[model samples]
Target: MKTKITNLQPGMIVGEDIYNLKNSLNLKKGQKLDRDMIDLILKSDITEIEIMDSNASIGFIQKTFEELPNIIDETIYNKWIDSISDLFHHFTKEEIYVSLNNITEEIYKSLNVKEYFVLNFINSFGNDSLTYHSLNTAIIVSIIAKKIEIPYIMYKQTVKFSLIHDIGYAMLDDRVINDFDSDDKNALIHNIVAYKKLQDLKATLNHEILESILYHHERYDGKGKFHLKGEKIPPLVRITQVADAYTSLTELGYTPYQALSWILKKCGFIFDPYYVGLLYEITGYYPTGTKVKLSDGSIGIVLRRNEIEFFPEVLVNNEPVKTGPDSNVYIKEVIE
Candidate 1:
């Protein structure tokens, strides 16, 4: 039975392969719909799904699912994932040097910025949080690059810097790294390790890029790993620092708004106030995919942020509501 997604009940079996608005298959046929799946579907902006009718033949539906490619495998999405994975794997190799510019151009040519953000929002809900965080930060770098209208060379360098900033963790034991908080001793060592590794690639790394990698964890107030204070931190490092923190917080189960709020609260002290402002322009008050509560106690998910800081297009009850001065609606808080 065709059913509105809101009407979907727990344990309701999916009748067919459920596709989102983009016609990308999300859930497969014969899978029993659960609360998490339903919520994910709604968050993805999928309005409806087919409910399984027990009286119908299961084989027919299964056959249909087999005929379609999984949404993650869709050409563009898969390519982006491959490119990110490839870059990540390169860090794991024993190569003494990597052509940073070559890798940057390869990824740049393979992705469309606008489409990449949408894909990131959709795919962030998946299991590979680490990879998504790296990619998300890189995408954010591009957005920041364009917004600041930096020279083309600097923009490319920023992308490369953000993407591999955490590659140092790749060399560490996952168990040990996860055992300690990011600010812990082991974690700090990994950052130093990654910085040194990049520094060793002197053939490709410049002083600026090397410092950004080494000092990305430096705080604006001087409480960071190396005790580098505000103004002492390099500009590129300051920008990537916020991007890394923002992505890490979100990956650790913080809602987008929750993460942004955390970043905002620490701005000027923990992060560069100027860069945080730039981040706000890119992510907005309510970033895309954040579930929010409105002034009137209604629940909604942010679709996109508009020119106004607080005002955004939200999906409330499956309807688009624009929040602005004209509308009485205001986002109360993020629904974590």
Candidate 2:
């Protein structure tokens, strides 16, 4: 049955999950809600209500998930993942030649004014495609920077650097570029080439920031691109490396949980320990879209974020779970 807020009552059944007026829907969760108390809502007009069909809607969603396009397909999208990734790709490759003067003038102005951008890429769309890859890298870097609450200027420039960082890949043939090992020494050559090209354009960038894009591949264990670590590696560079890997993996097929877990598990080995800790906290352990089981044995679709990494806003039996991090009630297990 379709869930309609207006038609709902405290004790009535909506979906597989039970309806508890006190604990569910705009209040602390995990217990039954009091109908007498819920009468207070009667005073206010119900402007917007969230609801879902318990059966057909959920199964349809699950079944149709894999059939969805692997890459950004829609000209318009409101979903979080689709919008962010698309923004990253679209901005970086908007022009074949992102000159330093143009990058400085155009990107700086755009970043200064707008908090976000969009990507509508189609001509190039694979690992072999250099422009798409660069855009992907920039967007992931920007996302990490934003999550860390980087200052607007720094965040904007980080994105600009990321966009120009992989310009050298255009020199390689499609086949070779496509098949090139992401970890291969040849990756450094791309940075080197891009760096020189940027210099020719008279790139107006801080030295450290420029190196971030050029040497982001450098590993902590001396096995990576520049083989440099400690203070020698710029902070943004390290951030980009981790974000780059996460984005590429996530874009390929791994879910957000999978990508973040990989980063968390590789702490200090491939990623900076400090940043790894921060990223782990920011991204959390379980994937965002994962379905979970509550301590009370109720199942809910993971609704976006709750204050706690593990705690997420949930929709139980077609009604929203309103508990928060400090609340005694929370998700307890993966429900499959």
lDDT of 2 by residue, 30-51 (tens): 1111243234334344422333
Could you give the C-alpha RMSD of every candidate to the true structure, in order shown?
11.5, 17.4
Clashes within 3 Å, all models in order: 0, 4
Which 10-residue span in candidate 1 carries the lowest summed lDDT? Answer: 59-68
Model 1, 218: alpha-carbon shift in Å? 1.0
lDDT, candidate 1, residue 195?
A: 74
After TM-score superposition, the amount by which residue 240's alpha carbon in candidate 1 deviates from its true location, in angstroms, is 1.0
Per-residue CA lDDT of candidate 1, range 62-115, in tens? Answer: 111222223233455445555665656576443423444554665566544343
Clash count in backbone of candidate 2: 4
Error of 1 at 23 (Å): 38
TM-score of each: 0.67, 0.55
